[model samples]
Target: MPHDQTTGIPPLKHALTRLLLILAIIAALPAAAESAGKPEAAPDIDIRTAQREFRLSSLRGNVIYLDFWASWCTPCRESFPWMNRMEQKYSARGFKIIAINLDEDRSRAEVFLKKYPARFTIGFDAAGKSAEIFDVRGMPSSYLIDRQGKLITRHIGFRQKDTAGLESAIRSALNRQESK
Candidate 1:
């Protein structure tokens, strides 16, 4: 094994350095392939709302507020009214809110619905397959999907104060589509 005496680094150390460089390059590939600040195409999940078959892909031309919520999440209630206002404000302009309930039991979600009762579409995903696709990190995770079906941004949790930012993103997304 030839060693670099001047540098005091052995041949094995050189090999390890090369291995580390390869690992680092491999680790960065996925993030590199992903376009920075570009919205990802959402998974078109087969889901049923209380009143309709909510085909996610059918909303290509419309801005989407795709939210994941569970009945037990308290912040979810706070998001409902804001979503309602948003829907009312933007629905005519080709915007819609789709709240996916990740409750294990539909009855619990139904009960919560009776209380917070959203004016927007509510879809049920008892198996949480949709959540897995979205890579939801929190109880009330949300994705702001643009009119072209690309994700604009995501919100991890909800609060009354979060509405301003959320609304701004929504407006920006809506207007961005209108121009195109």
Candidate 2:
């Protein structure tokens, strides 16, 4: 009797080959998905200064915790200390914090800074351009921007317990930059 070519291969061998192919395809999916969804680092977004004329880009080689806040916001005020601490701890490791004040009056920002005494870089968004660009809907909103200038995460509200999570996120961003 002549053997059928399809049946010549053992059933176990056919099943094993199919399983291997499925596994290989599954392994490739994650890489393809990541490549498709990965965000391009945008380090070129210039921040408008307090005078509402000068545009300045945030630091390029650092993880930037860009906090959009107003002096009158209680939650913004409360988050200041935690932000300051994170700045103090990570500034040396290429981590930077930029407090962009949303107040129309630069004096309000100056006063708030005086009271809080943040060591990180401060910028004034007197014309509210930063808020509009970042789409800030409320005070105390923050965006964690990676070293390559891609926005990694955004938080709309401030909570004391979130400090660790934010710090870890910054660290992860830094690590990703370093690896690349």
Candidate 3:
């Protein structure tokens, strides 16, 4: 009996503690696995743009600043001007910003655009095919893609504070294009 409970803890307490620990560990798993690593190619996006057909595969030779946006997403609105500036600043250096609108209704996207216009290629993904391929878990998700179509960086959410970091990554990706 002395060795049976030498630690001074009861069996029920020990079991509950172990169970809670396991549950806590289980809760941490999804957070730990959130990263979508570099993919060989971004999802094949063939969507309608205001001007013409927009295809991700067609832009294979340029650094692509791909962003998933929704009309209701406030951060998506904030991202537009920053992305527009980026497009103007870097387009001459072979960079392209492709903002994929994911509003369920095209009219919502149109309305949103009337408020926050993007200067780059704005495409429609009403069916969410590209967002599915990218495993998007949040609004305004974005990815930096290299000239060879490799997904270089995946960002889940956007903040106004995130602009500089995002721009730096884009600059790094654009610079890589010069060497190749």
Candidate 4:
């Protein structure tokens, strides 16, 4: 094997080193492309509830409505019934709603849930860590994630009149195909 006079490294070893560097750069291209303009992946949610622990990744391949709420938020109260209806209407079509409560007091959330009655999955984040992960800026923020785990849209608040528009977004997501 010929040695490189400059650093005493073997020519074959130097060639292999350059090849590895090229391979590493090629391996990073896809990740760079994904980060450049592609839709961002929804942040994972690992939260606990009274019934069981919930993970956002478990519902991959389903369009997800990830909502962050608190007990004192009046708009959250209004959104629960609509979310329940959406869950019922879309579950069979590969849609799931995971609403995470940001209330520090679990009892407050329990009382609120008793009144609102969520049919969708409920996650309790008493420490508000999930809210921070989602960058929740308001009480009733919601994110619509496509089936491929990309975030499609975010709604900051809920209103009765927004029902049709929100449902339309969900339907569009349900109908959308994964980007090639």
Which number leads on TM-score?
1
* Cα lDDT tens digits for candidate 2, 114-175: 88877766777678766887778887889887766777888988987887798789888878
TM-score of each: 0.80, 0.72, 0.76, 0.76
Model 4 misplaced stretches (Cα beyond 4 Å): 1-37, 178-180
Model 2 CA lDDT for position 71: 88
Clash count, candidate 1? 0
Candidate 2 lowest-lDDT run of ten = 49-58
- Cα RMSD for candidates in order: 4.5, 7.8, 6.0, 9.5
Reference-based lDDT, residue 158, model 2: 91
Residue 134 lDDT (model 3): 85
Candidate 4 lDDT over residue span 109-157, tens digit each: 9999889899988899988898998899997999999887888888999
Candidate 1 vs candidate 2, lDDT winner: 1
Reference-based lDDT, residue 107, model 1: 99
For model 3, give the RMSD to the true fold: 6.0
lDDT-sorted candidate list, best first = 1, 4, 3, 2
For candidate 2, list the clashing residue pairs, or say none. Answer: none
Candidate 1 residue-wise lDDT at 45: 76
